[model samples]
Target: MKRVFNKFLIQPKIVLSIFLLTSLIVLISALLEYNQSKKEINKLMENQSHTLLDAILISSNDAIKSYNLIKSEINQRLLNNAIFIKYLYENNLLTNSKLTQIAKENELFRINVFSKNGSRLFSSHPLSKFEQTFQNKSKEILKEIFNGEVDTLQIGIKESQLSNSYRYVVAVAAKDRSAIVINIDANKLVELRKESGFGPLLKKFTQNKNIIYLIFQNENGIIAASGNFKDLDDLNSSSFLQKSFNEEKFYSRIFETDSISVFESVNALIINNSKLGIIRLGLSTEPLDQIAQKIINRTIIQSIFLLVFGVITFSFLFIRQNYDSLSKKFRSIETYFKNIFDNVSDSIILFSNKLNIEAVNNSALELFNSKDKYELELNFNSFFVDLIKIDFTILEKEISINDQTKFLLISKTIFNDEAISNKFIFVIKDITHQKIIEKQNIRNQQLSALSDLSSSVAHEIRNPLNAIATITQQIGKDFTVNENENEFKQLTKIVYKEVKRINSIIESFLKFARPLPINTESFSLKEFFMQLKLQYQNIFNEKNILFNIQLNKDTQVKWDKFQIKQVFINLIENSIDAVNNNGTISVFAHEIDNKIEIKFSDTGKGIQEDILDKIFNIYFTTKNNGNGLGLSIVQKIINEHNGLINVTSKINNGTTFTLILPKVVEVKNV
Candidate 1:
């Protein structure tokens, strides 16, 4: 019993489990605290918004009263001026200059006089442009004035003119139905309303800066605005303000910009039994945000303090009880496995039957060219596919990764232990380079045997072919033929032509059997391609094909100039034959990773896929007259230069041949 108890006490997993449980409790507590604080702050802000709306309503009411008082005073002043102007025009003391002097003295916008029949007789300014319209509009105000309602002439504000300035028209009636009309500038009245009413009230109420903006607007548009006038102008046509205005009630909403949160309140301003306008106030909620941040900060501090205290207490107790034994055992086990994992050459990946990677050693990471174990696990299926079966024995397969075709000898086995069960253990071995070398060796042996056989046959055939050609030519030159014997002479000519063709075939075979020795030298690729372009210019022109060469820079490569030139010439000739009129061929050369890569792309009839692999075989020809030795020789020369050649083609689309050659070469004396 004591031993069992001691084992349980010393187990590190128990301590870890307790720590995790404690951390979970702390996280839950923090979340609850944060949510509760947010709810409380939101409730408080809602109440504050109500109070702020009430304050804005009271302030805006006072401002509207002030506006009404200023409007009444302005109206009275305009009526008195109109009555005085009517008295002067009735007495006939209002000459043109006197009317203009009176207009200037009173600082009126304009003044006009009408005859007893409501026709304009005279004016301080030009009346021809507006006299008819003014008389037509003043008929109503003239009726009111002539009715003598309350014995005081009154002025009424009109809508803005084309100049966007307000106009006020006042009419005063005389005994003969004659009246004087005056137009007063209402822009000054607007200035007075702003200075005495909304402007001062807004300034006084929003002194705290929390009320960031205040605006007063009537049916005539924005009359007074303060604090971010541009923002107020933007809200002039807001749906929220329109709804509040239509409903004639106070409405509140929250608006947020990139930097600040604003609680906006809209209320109708009613004074003297009429709605003056709606008042809008934008109150910043930055203080409430500050309160929320403080709550979160306080909760975090308390949580961290508790967590640290608990950790310190548990660590002290654990160290006093079991530190030495656990440390020694852990170090021993870690070192034991680390040395084995690091020293092994083969990559070893341990995964589950579900193909999820459990662990990877150093070799496995390096083999996959990865930095993390999780990355390998996530992309495990990409590296190996269709790996479903796992038994006690190992299975091997090849896979490709990152566009590189590699030979991987994979083995799978089951791992059954206490911590894990039915897990897969994969051991991968790369054998791509070895496979290539083996195939190259086999091909080299075959080529060597074929070369020897072809050499012997070509040598034997060349002598007989030369002798036959000489005899046929000599017979043709020595004998004379008549009209009946013309057929005989034609047959001799055919014999000589056949002999020459056979000799040419034998010469090709001999050259294939033993190629010319490579004389290596360094030459500029730019100049070399330039010369080649010049050589092929006429051929391209005859075929109506375009040829282009793109070079990144001047590059020098040590190669046999004659052999490489022959390779390019053969490729170009094939390209020319493959294309018809208006085709294009392009050559590109650049240096990458200390190697020169050259690509020849042609817009021509491309080779089919099925026969592309066999194109380099001896005696294989796609064309009736082709000898099938050109590409084979090109391949041989490139191989001798220690380069790689590959082709990609699509039928009817085009073909591209890529050659990668070493920039520097070292030739050994043979």
Candidate 2:
């Protein structure tokens, strides 16, 4: 029984099992907390959106009241003034600027005097020369004003500039059949409506994140305000706006979009016995996603931390509780914990709930500049404060510690319930390394796919090009000299030149996709270039371009001699293409720090900046008659040799290509 008890107490598996169980419990608690918070936030947003819509309706009511008072004054003036009656009898309405001035002083956008029959006689806005109709749409307001059913009424007409915008008016009919109309600026009304919706305060709260508040008006929705304008235009549709126009009260709904979860609410606006509009407030789910990720991360970290602590505690107890009890069992337990520490992908750290750094493993030490685990003997929270110096509460969510993203997946649990309530475990994982590896893998995949396509395309094009070259050569040779023969010869020569260029393009593509086999042999750089200089001597002389070769004595590298020669030939040819009549091309090779370095520079019209990055990308060329594969093939050859190649160029100045190949360490066959 004692033996079995000791096995249970000292085993690493039991300790790790406890850690796993604790992680599961903490994760469950975090999930519950997150769900509860989300529900509460959603409810609050719904209430707020409804309140905003209600306010818009109230504003609309106040506008109607002001319209009615103006109409009553117009009716009284028509009955009292004989001159006004005469003016109305001769013309449909009066166009006196003094009357229009009175309305303009009140901040109205437009004012028009119309006859009882609705013909516009006066307008405050500049009327278009071709326009024959007025913008006012509320004929009901005009009918009531003329018939004395209502003293006055507000009418809105859609403006021509905006598809659904309304030009608001307060119309009053005079006793002489003349009508006075006051136009309210739609923009000003919208601004007042948005301000009344409690948006300014809500916007202040969400300035740091994404939130959108909307109001529905006359079967159309308007985004009164938004904290984030990522998808602001979505509110322009009539269907989305009209849905909440009939709702009597407020309600909330959640919608999932391509990237965000939107929490939405609808609330009605009723003012002065008229339903004006509805309001909706939306909160994006990005924050909730971040919160969920935080919880999961914390659970994983805490579980791993607890497992490590348990292993250490069990091992120490086994050593102290009579060394002979289970010495072999303790060793195995220690090794098991060591394997977990070494093999885990993310770096691991254990911090007590008080936020003290208790222990760190090898991975953590290497990442955080600690020589050993014992060197990490500082309060975790205090260490974070000293390093980053940000507010702890804000740092708790997203924190960067010493160039490493120390994502804290944290969990809290009481050990005995009284003195250690602050006790918690934290797991720190380095996501930077993982991201770097992922990026490299993606780049490799892209290059490989492009290379495979280039190979097939090159093969398909080169065979047809060879046939064209043969046909051109045959046509040139078989033609006899005569008046028509001269024209035929020139045609064949042009065809031959084009075919050769095509063949050159195909060869470069093949080189990029399938590198020539390397027959590695030690060769002196001085002798190799000497042969190249002699071979290309006549071509350089004919072009009148200076060809300079600089070589360091006894410089050697292991590479296929022919392949390296081809690399130089392609580079030199490009330099010639870029050069003016007397431009200079210089080639230099040397032994530098256990590697062979080669540089080819040209004093030619330099490459443009926009095309620099694309120089090595397949099918990217600046030359009209050029195949864009030269630099791509150069990069492929350098990569095959386990070397680095880079180019720099400046427009109208020069271009230089640098190649560095590592020294080969030979493995001798026995």
Best by lDDT: 1
lDDT of each: 0.75, 0.61
Per residue, candidate 2 scores C-alpha lDDT tens digits across 297-336 of 7656865676567656755654575566467689889899
| Cα lDDT of model 1 by residue, 548-607, tens digit | 999999998898899899999988988888887789999999999999989998899998
CA error at residue 203 for candidate 2, angstroms? 99
RMSD of 1: 16.9
Looking at model 2, residue 187 earns an lDDT score of 51
Clashing pairs in 2: 216-278, 221-241, 298-409, 298-410, 353-423, 353-424
| Model 1 accuracy (lDDT, Cα) | 0.75
